[model samples]
Target: MINGISYYPEGRKYTYFLKSEEYKQILDRLEINYENIRLYFSHSISFESKNILEIYLRKCVLDDTLDLFNFFEPILQECFEPETNQYKFEQIVDLVIIEKASNI
Candidate 1:
């Protein structure tokens, strides 16, 4: 019954919300051994507007070259683009990972 809530007061960062039971259910459904399984979660925020997104990429990656933009364009489009321009300001990612048992 693990629960977490993160608030980004300035809205500059991504906020993540997760429940342990839901993750456990997924592991159970997949028949993944959970005896010593470990889980990790992380998230980030991105802009949807191509112009703003390009600016952001440049700041973060230190490169605004066309090759870089093209490399990340498709993935960003699918993950960050919003239905409406008004709602395209930000995107929050919810990342989850399962760590293997030490014994294994």
Candidate 2:
């Protein structure tokens, strides 16, 4: 397993978390494929407020999870803005984590 976990077993093989602008950039890079699109909006509030995009890919384009992370890292680092601060962002993330886990 990679990163002390089995990504396949976790059912996260096709799931991705990305910033909206970064997501747009990637989409532009692959301009031909626009017919397949799904967007799940995450609205969160805590000491800080934030937003997130959970994108369910229709196909496997990236080679591996590491590649996915690397692809998203630059985008995330360059533009991760919350309506509030870090603490609130964490709270929202926690809520998302819990909701996602419960759904499984």
Candidate 3:
């Protein structure tokens, strides 16, 4: 749960295709050209004005990339910490959560 709200992204079944563009702008902030992430709406409570930018890890990265974990480690670490992310807060998304899964 983030900010006292839990929109179960782990359940997966409840997440649907998000056609709204309100949150798209912030999405680019999550997926960078150098990271091993294929950004998608794994789960989001956009209807309630809460969005979680879910990114999956992969191998390949374009340009002079910092692998998957290396690049996002700082960002993820910041999220895990108690400090508030001013940049994320400014966007439509309240938090960016990461989960490692073998079975989808």
User: Candidate 3, 46: how far from true, in Å?
Assistant: 20
Q: For residues 1-104, write the lDDT of model 2, one tens digit per residue.
A: 01111223343445564644565566556553333234434433232222222221112233344444344444334334455532211212111111122222
Best by TM-score: 1
TM-scores for every predicted model: 0.29, 0.21, 0.21
Please write out the lDDT profile of model 1 over residues 2-102, one tens digit for every residue. 11112212222343334566777877777665543344433234444556556655553443343545655544554553544321323333345555644
In model 2, which regions exceed 4 Å deviation?
Answer: 1-60, 65-67, 84-104
Task: Score each candidate by Cα lDDT.
Answer: 0.45, 0.33, 0.33
Clashing pairs in 3: none
Candidate 2: worst 10 consecutive residues by lDDT? 89-98
- lDDT-better candidate, 1 vs 3: 1
lDDT of 2 at 81: 47
Query: lDDT of model 3 at residue 65?
Result: 35
* Whole-model alpha-carbon lDDT for candidate 1: 0.45
Which of 2 and 3 is ahead in lDDT?
2
